[model samples]
Every structure is written in structure tokens, then in C-alpha cells.
Target: MFFRIINRIQPCTSQQRLLSRSPALQNSLLQQFFDDEENFGKQELRAKKRPGRSWTNEELRLKSSEDLHKLWYVCLKERNMLLTMEKAHKATARHFPNPERLDRVKGTLKNIEEVVHERNDAYYQLETGDSASAPKRTVTSFMGFTYEKRAEEHYSPPGEGQKGYEVPYLDDDAYLMQKLWNEKELCKERDRKDNLARRQLANDEMKHYKRGGRRTFDRLEDLKVYQ
Candidate 1:
């Protein structure tokens, strides 16, 4: 299946595309900085068809490397275009059309990157005998518990030639204080639950009484039957 997918992929291009501004948008050299001339300072919003949703990870996974490369640029251009129009609108005190498009564009870019990373990891696993996942290290926490921690990109694992954190020693006094606090919290929670259950029981009893031709309880003490 992997070989078949690879065979279906087209050759990726090496040329870099311009951001936001397409070649056809260039009426003059000065217009290259913006997406399009009509995009800037357009206050009136046209209630035409809304934009489509972003490319999902599953859809991107089925695409070829060449398709992903082109898609990345398309999303990048859209993000840039959105930013440009937003800035223009803000400067002129006008509303930007479809402000949510920026978020959608960013989501699409993220999906593309995730799909590309999956492919790269698969390729690495096929060629090399290891996965291309982030590096993990076993480290002991301040609570004296050991766990495997995955290191993010451009970050080193904690306690790896770094100044380890200083945890205050737990003495008898600290233990007693923590125990008291836990007991107090537990008592509060129990009281809350008991109050809620009592209230519910009273409400149910009142409902039953009303159905039995009793409009109201004789006294406040009558509602304390649960006690």
C-alpha cells in the first residue's frame, strides 16, 4: 500500500511561489506588496457565497507530496492576504470581510504540515529502523516519581546538565498541614453533596404532597423529614 501510494505521487516542484500576491495580480510593481488592488480599503461587504472549509488532515493525507507543497503555498497566501486586508480595514476604520478566514487558513496550513510530517515519519521508519518521533527521556519529578517525558523540538529534557529544581523537603509538620487541608476539603465536599441531596429530597416530597391535595407543608419543620 505504501509503495502504491508513493507511485501515485507526482514529482514535486522546486520553484518558490510568491506569497498572497499572484502573478496576475501585478498591475504594477507597487501592487506586489498587497494581494490585490480591490482587496485594500474596500468598506462594502458583498453577501455572496461564503468561503469553503479548510483542508482536513484526512483529505491532506490522501494527497501527493507535490499537492501538499502547492497547498501549503495556497494556505500561506490566503493567510497573508487576510492579514493584509485586515490591516487595511483597521487603518481605514472599516470592517474586514470574513475575519474568520484567517483562522481557517491557519488551520489548513497546520493540517498540511501534520500530513507532511506523517509522510516523513513513515518514510523514515521504512528506511531507518526507528520512528521520526520526538526524543523521549526518563526523568524523576519533584514528587520523586519517574516517568518517560517526550522532548519537544528545540528543547532539552529537564535535569539534562541543567540546574535541577529544588523541592522543599516534606517534614512531619508539612505532612500534618497537608493532611489537615485534605480533611477540610473533603468535609466541605461532603457537606455540599449532602445539602444537594437533602434539597432534592425536599423538592420531591413537596411535589408528592402537592399531588396528594396538600398545597403547602404545614411548617418548615415538616420539610425536615430527611433528618
Candidate 2:
């Protein structure tokens, strides 16, 4: 009976010694792994770090298709992460650093779309019957200048004459009358100002000539003798 009790006590003592010897075993035994002050400090330090900024075009161009695809996912994840962080910050009444990161992500997405469009346009022009360039229609403006209007796909019925859509007539009697009246008035005003300016210039020249003749009055006898 005494030997059995001693063996049981020896096993319990050995187990305690083993637990104390290993930090992991001690933590497992106590259930206090995360309760350490150093780990808590490290967590706080990691949380304080700001994420990287926007991606450049060169960097994006250099990336392979696989990399670009992965980048897209990463950008999406980053946007979501920022949003979540922003929400949490707002909840906690703290200022979020680098708020423009969301806008940068949006700009990057737009750039990606632009690049995709360029590639699609090149591919479509090579394979399809239609040109990738924008369709244009010649239109006469109110000023009688011909301009090209961009053509877009539409399913609406043609308005008025079916042969060709009638451009709303700016040459209607009322509109023409108003335009002619304005033009005539402008021309008349311009002519009146021009004539006034010419008359003033002529008068100034006459005065200058008279002053020259007066200055040469002492030479008037020499002039008569020569005559």
C-alpha cells in the first residue's frame, strides 16, 4: 500500500515538472497563451502599420496575365479590407489613415478596364466585319458648318421623313429674319465706328499739314520767286 502511493505521487510530480519546463505545456495547462503582455504589444504594433499606396501603370503593364488576375483579386480584397477598417474606425471614433486608398483602387479598376478595352478593340477589328472605331454621321449645324455626330445603337422609330431625318430647320422664316436683323445691325454699327475713326484720322492729318505750312511762311517769298 505504501509503495503504490509513492508511485502515484512520483508520476504527478514528474508531470508538474514537465509542464513547468515547457512554456507551451504550461500555457496549455493554464489556458493563458494569449494573455501574455508581449504578444498583446506586438498585436498593437502590427495594427498600427499603414497599408501600401496605389499601383502605377508601368507596374501593371509589366505584370503577367496571371499576375494581373491575382492583382485584381488583391485589389478587390484591399478595397473590402479598407472599407471594413474604415467602418470599424468610425465606430471607434478614430481617424482612418490614407482614406484616398479607396479612390486609388477605383482609379486602378478604371485603368484596367481601359487596357481591356484597348485589347478588345484590337482583337475585334482583326476578327469582326465592323471597325472598332466609333461610328460617325455627318450633321449640318445651325451655322451651316458640317460636323460629325457620334452614332450609337438605337431601336427607336425614325422621326418625320423616312428618307433621311430632317434636321430641325434653322433657316425657318422667323429664325432667318432674327439672324439677318442681328447681322445687319452689327454691320451698320461696325461701319459707323469705322467712318468716325477715318474722319478723325483725316482731320488730324490736315491739322499737321497746316502746321507745317505755317512753319514755312518765312520761306513763302522764296516759294513765290521760284514760281
**Top lDDT hit:** 1
Each model's number of backbone clashes?
0, 0
Please write out the lDDT profile of model 1 over residues 6-97, one tens digit for every residue.
Answer: 12212122211222234433445534334443333334435543477898998987889998999898778768767765775565455666
Estimate every model's Cα lDDT from 0 to 1. Answer: 0.61, 0.55
Where is model 2 poorest over a 10-residue stretch in terms of lDDT? 34-43
Judged by lDDT against the true structure, how good is candidate 1?
0.61
After superposition, candidate 2 runs with Cα above 4 Å error: 1-48, 91-93, 129-168, 171-227
Q: Provide TM-scores for the models.
A: 0.53, 0.40
True-structure RMSD for candidate 1:
13.9
- Alpha-carbon runs more than 4 Å astray in model 1: 1-50, 143-148, 152-227
Q: List the residue pairs that clash in candidate 2.
A: none
